[model samples]
Target: MWRELALGLAGPLSPMRQAQPVGFRAGQAVTQREWRAEVAGWAAHFAAQPGADVALYFEDSLRAAAALFGAWHAGKTVWWPGDALPATAERLAAQGTHFAGDWPGGACARVAPQPEPEPEPEWQPLDAQAPALVVFTSGSTGEPVAITKRLHQLFDEVRALETCFGSRLEGARVVGTVSHQHIYGLLFRLLWPLAAGRPLVAERQAYLEDLTRLDARLALVASPAHLKRLDLPDLAGLPVRLAAVFSSGGPLPDDALAPCAEGLGQTPIEVYGSSETGGVAWRQRAPGADAQHPWRALPGVDWRIEDEQLALRSPQLGSLDWFLAADRVRAEGPGFVLLGRADRIVKIEEKRVSLAAIEQALLALGGVQELRLPLLPGRRQELGVVLVPTAEAWEAIETQGRAAWLAPRKRALEPLLEATVRPRRWRLVSELPVNAQGKTTQAALAALFDPMRPSARLLQREAQRACWAIEVEARHPGFDGHFPGHPVLPGVVQLDWAERFGREAFAHLQPAFAGLDQLKFQQVIPPGACVELELQCDEAGCVLRFVLRSARGPHASGKLRFAAAGEGA
Candidate 1:
């Protein structure tokens, strides 16, 4: 049964029986009645809260879904922030929104379980025009901006989804790697499933091995970031059969299309839109198709082009007036071809340049796995490329110096881009620096060239180990008061970084520091020098090994022992 978004929690979306599976968590089923009772519990608790706006963050989609509907049922507008970072917390607090659901810093009012909710009259359906949600953009271009969505708009979007793609996903369990905090994830991973009576998987698949372990009929809700990593040769195909696969948050790279076909058993339907626009269109690539295919408009969504920028008028836009989008497009037969983003065009040295074109050229070189070319300001504005290289390119860069591998790529791009718009600064990385939504922000991208602080960026990460490439800027505080004219990195700072990384990699263990063995500082690590810190798990139950090295040699290497069961050291 496909329930309308207007019906929401009050409507009978699923059988309200004790055994009806509402969601799946770690392979266990959560009952529909159990979830309903939790939603009622949240509503009761929210009735006592003074504020009408709640900022929510939860890694588990089902629990977050309960909190969302509960607040809405209580006449509150829920704000979905992609992260609970300090900056986001401050912003929410500034807006007088109460923190809720898995937010850190003890800022949230925890949701309580309702084993036996007091039987009362059924809840009334929410008003269709009332404000229901405020979602933040992914911050790919700049700081995140909030977009308010009304219940009527969301209800229409859900109905549209049910009308267009409902048949293929009948009774499919929704599985996802993306967090529900983002708009795309919130729709496909949580809301759509509940509206259509499909089960949702609670925990995200952090590693491909975890997804491979599942034996269920599933519909994957994924982003380009996660889908691009699934191209592996050791695995022939995923054992778990998928009913459907959906991709958004960016275009699925042409290279990743085959992996989805191989591992997922179906060509993924790519949904195109933004937080502000909801969903405007979707398209799936047919086998053997090589050219960029035009995207068909979503149900009840109408599109037009004026001055090369695409504009839309649909129920999803929340108005009849056309909402102009940032993307430039060309009309094709019964569809449109996306040219690039008109908003990303930047002016450099009295010359106009398309940052999207520059980015496309870098991506076309084939070495780049992911990248962001943002305009950096100075006396002369220049571009900086924060790039994550592919596995093949990474191996070559590690063996041959980065300059050797990057030289030919730069030579190839010299013809594709204007010299004035060429990236002046480069930060080669293993992973893109992004928020929980996998959108790289302007500040994070610019941090690579920041001279005031020491930054640790990921170079590579594996099951047993994690490696970070740290750049100690010339004016880093680690240099202060070390020597009159000469400055060296302190041993304490190096140890601190190693310990911090271990904490992240082994967070589940809650490992407590006990003692250290094999500690050695071989060479003086000077300021303004770059180094690599590698943290690895030792086979012994409680030992963690680390190495701090540079081009010169190993600066330090040691093994750290943590407290074991009932043992101090």
Candidate 2:
């Protein structure tokens, strides 16, 4: 692998060397030689610190590569913590010793950058099975799981790349908009180009305008998140040869694929794999291609079905045979079709329903850009959907009764019926929150739907100020043991709920809270408490008076105040 990279760098016969790949920015281009020098210098510096796990967090590709190679040459495991939250970083730091990519405030030795040499050494062969890269998987609930792969596994992934895209990528300059930390970015942006003896563009282009200034025939490695932002009409006139456009992280919405293909003149090649099993399959989003097939394993890799889930054993990871995956797949002649994750499927009222399937169906609807379907805890008959609607569609849904819009099963139900297992709450949104990989978190989805705790209270504007009432409700069935035995709603959850209610009430204003005064919890409101909340607004923000009421009487009561951040237009 290293040898090919070196040849691509120095060999006169190498296509990459002859082409002199350039990193295009606002209006300027940086040559491959300059990029190599910067990275080599960082490698030399990183080599000074032996055995220290280094975190590479640069936003720029050239800098990121330099930090990565530097740590690699130092023989230290490099941790690409992608866009992990601060809490995640603290958790990782607690688990192992780490050197930050950015300079520390108080450090001992400062390694100086070295000059580029005239003759580069021949690339040395790397042990295929030796641990080389560590990427993280966003765990289902809490901490992210760190998965390690050997150099050979990466090589196998590159081999898969050749089979899937060899025809299109010959002598193509590789440019990427995805982060180099994740598997998708690691394989497409760094390893694939290095293995194929192709020069990679050192900058990460975020906007379509930035990509347009570059030379044509470029292989763009991007994610569905990045691609979704592109305006097809703007990209249509650019000189993009578009050897291939690769997307991963999540299923690329079909609506996005058609226009992007029409604009770029090439169908996007989507890769399906995870942190545990490197590269699994590749499929082009052509007109009639099966949207559900598992990627054909590379030449040497073997695949089989274990308990309805796909299992793979590759020569890349020696001694490790049959790594089980979460994806559910069925045989399709030479290949297999993916049927979503087995874990993502939930059983509601004896009916098996896949949240991913429901979300896909909702996305297929007109003006629905993105949607999330999460089963509310303890509610066997209830489901919640957070949807982002187009401006026109948003108006239509608001004007047309929300219940009227649903055909039958898609609508909410009052009394739990045998056949009424559809989503109960449908929250309209301008945009959905997505993680770095473009996947939404359960917590984020819950925030969109529930917004506030039952104990919290806020003021709402009615037609007149003649009436005031304390409304309290417990809708979350999971609220029972959000804590152990002394289950009281979390403070942050209460604050989130208040903010959500305020945002809805004062849609035109950005509401802020000065403070909560005389906040008292009178009683324990268990899960499933139907509560009512009333709010009164004055110059000193809005005051919330809430009561968690049951069928008999009030279960709990509380007051909250929300101050407007600043004067609004």
For all predicted structures, in order, the TM-scores are: 0.62, 0.58
User: Pairing residues by index, what is the TM-score of model 1?
Assistant: 0.62
User: What tens digits encode model 1's per-residue C-alpha lDDT throughout 1-569?
Assistant: 34434676564433445567879987999888777888888887776789889888888888898888888888999999866666578788899998888877775766645646466327788888998899865233444468899988877887888788989887678888777887788888888888787888999876554666677777888776667677455334463467787888776667667776777677788998877889999999965554378999999999999999999999989899999898899999999988877675454542335565566657777888788886675645588877888888878876896779788767755643446556767777667655445667787677656553355667667666888888766677667788768888788777877776665445433356778899999999887678988988764536778999999999999988877656755
Q: What is the TM-score (0 to 1) of candidate 2?
A: 0.58
Model 1 clashes, total count? 0
What would the per-residue lDDT of candidate 2 be over residues 69-188, giving only the tens digit for each residue? 655655667777655445445655675745554433423223337665764433344444556667665444323467776666776667767766778887677888777766677678
Candidate 1 colliding pairs: none
Candidate 1 runs further than 4 Å off: 11-18, 113-117, 138-143, 231-240, 287-291, 345-569
> Local error of candidate 1 at 254, Å?
1.1
What are the per-model numbers of colliding residue pairs? 0, 21
Candidate 2: Cα lDDT at 136: 64
**Global CA lDDT of candidate 1, please?**
0.75
